[model samples]
Target: MIFFYIFLLLFPHQICQAEVNSNMEGKLLNDLLKDYNKMSRPVKNLSSPLEVTINIGTFESFDLDEISQTISVLLYITVSWVDKFLTWNPEEYSGINQTRLPAGQIWIPDLQLQHTPIGSGMLSTESNAILDSSGLVKHTPPGTIKTICQEMDLYKFPYDTQTCTIEHLSFTHPSNELFLRLGDFTLDQNTFQSQEWQLLNVTSRIEINYYGGPYPFQKHIICLMVKRIPNYYISNMIYPYAVLASVAGLGFTLPPDSADKLSLGVSVLLSTTFYAGMVADIVPVTTSMPFLGLYCLVMMSLVAFSVVSTLAVINLHNRGEAKMSYLQKTIFLKFLPSLLFMEKKSKPSQVQRNTNHKGKVQVETLNDSSKEVEQEQAKDWKFAAKVLNEFCMIIFSAGFFIIFAYTIFFL
Candidate 1:
């Protein structure tokens, strides 16, 4: 019963105090806006332009559409200027030194992107701004900005860096009427990280409009330097092609006498073609080819070539005795085989003398007209086929390493 009486006694006192505080704020607001013109410029001196300092607080969402060549950013920016006409005495208004008001009630500069569509304004509308008794007005407006950027360089994609730009310019006002300056750009640590792209650095500057004509329009440009995070592409696209190419190259080392050599080449070739198709579906459709796409296409072609080379090797292996040309003998049979550490097989010699039955001595002579000479020719043909197989292995191996190495380190 005592606590209920105490609550009843405090209710009227609380209502009276609330009413007094409300009246004080009401009088302060009314006195500040008395005879004030919202549309008029806040400049007390007509000899100089009003200087507005804009500070970029943070960037939340950064999206770069490479296909469209545009960058869209969500900006949290604060613009502040001294409004000379909005000043008031804080002591007369119950020490109310600060207040909030809708931004549409005051005069704000008209801003638009330099590369955006004409007549499309960029400023946010009707947001609340904090006003101080000393005539300082600060407005933080959240807005989405989409602007054209430089052409994306995709030749070194998966290891490429792109520079994109966004410029905010004064649309309706010239440099003499309203001066604009950039304060600083702060990148929050959590928001700067992207899954596919990493923020490398940022640069900002103020430049005069090139198409401003005789009137000078000012612009604040912020350029973002971002690099591609290549881990995803390496795992999904490049690494698999490398492993598939190794499988195809091994077909050249397979023995030509068996069907497994042809089978392996055909299977790997088909697999490469299918995999390349999958990669093409996911990659951006562009007139010029990206480095990764080009690498994949070349790998598919090499796999197909391996299949053809294996067929020729199989055909060359199953041949009968035939004479080799001078070029074939000197180059394929001797010099090239020696470079591959393959020496030509020596011709077998027939027994010159033999003992006959009953322990009696008998003589037999070897001659060039003997049947062994034809057998030796057959052996030479087979040896030459072995040399060609080794040669193809080297060629396929060289091709794989050269393209893969360049893609990894250089491109």
Candidate 2:
């Protein structure tokens, strides 16, 4: 009976041990199955089949200078890709064998790229191409491992390349507009549409920078640098002022003897003043005066001289009883007569005349021939004055018209 009790205890312990062994074996088998499944799983394989194309469009220059040329270009880029998964056991999984992944299934987040001219010179061969590095490329798929369908780059690209064909290169002087052509490109045999690009308006100033190098054989180095300068169409505002000033200056040539001299001077001065005010309204007050300002100033000086000269001429003419200096006599008698075509005539004879009181007094009477000659002299002076006045007016009018016409049409 005691032996039977011992056997029961030993049997229970053996059963417990068997159960433990079975549990361990089952766990080990499960672990092995899990590892095998992991090893046999299909592996994701991603590849990018790159088809690159560049479509360079027409270049437009908004502004340009001697040293640097600002240009713009349209770049068309198309990117595509393929996503595939390697099947570990295609025979085991019919779905895996049948499934075909679409093209461009893999995503490329973004493309960061740059273009540099392939030349030795410091000046970039590309006149108008500039690229911004920040956020250059953006893919449609939002998440990690997102599927990529297709990518495209459509915008202006700044750069010049020898490999690219230039089309429609043209330049307009003074306007500073330049046009150039870059190469055309296509993706996957697709037709590329032409693009038009306009560059930024730029005004540049160039300067030479010189450097002296150390060593006896070293040569002086010179480098050209360009800086952008801001500009405006101030010429338009200045031209009108210049024209008005030139027209006003014509008033100076009018005859000094006329009563209209002061009137004309005042009228011209007021007119020019109005024009100057108009010019000031349009242009900013800067330290440096423009070319038009110089012209106006010169006109003002001439007008002032005309006023003084007119006063002097009137003073000389009115001083009739005043004894004239030799210089004055020479100018009035010799020079004036020659210039005005006043010819000298024979003197009248002296004659005797009787008064009402019966006393005879000797009186001088001009003979008929001498009287006729005196009248002719007076007529000649009047005619000469009229002719001189008309001549001056014609000249002034012609000059004023010319200046006005130029300002209106050509300036």
lDDT of each: 0.79, 0.35
Off by over 4 Å in 2: 1-260, 280-291, 340-352, 355-411
Please give, for residues 61-138, the per-residue lDDT of candidate 2 as tens digits.
212211122212222222222212221333333212222221132223122221212222121121212111121111
In TM-score terms, candidate 1 sits at 0.82
Compose the digit string of candidate 1's lDDT tens values, residues 299-363.
98888888888887776676665666798788767897889998875855565666777887766
TM-score of each: 0.82, 0.33
- The root-mean-square deviation over C-alpha atoms between each candidate and the true structure, in angstroms, is 3.8, 21.9
Stretches of candidate 1 above 4 Å error?
A: 1-47, 84-87, 91-93, 116-121, 278-289, 321-323, 351-378, 406-411
Q: Which candidate achieves the best lDDT against the true structure? A: 1
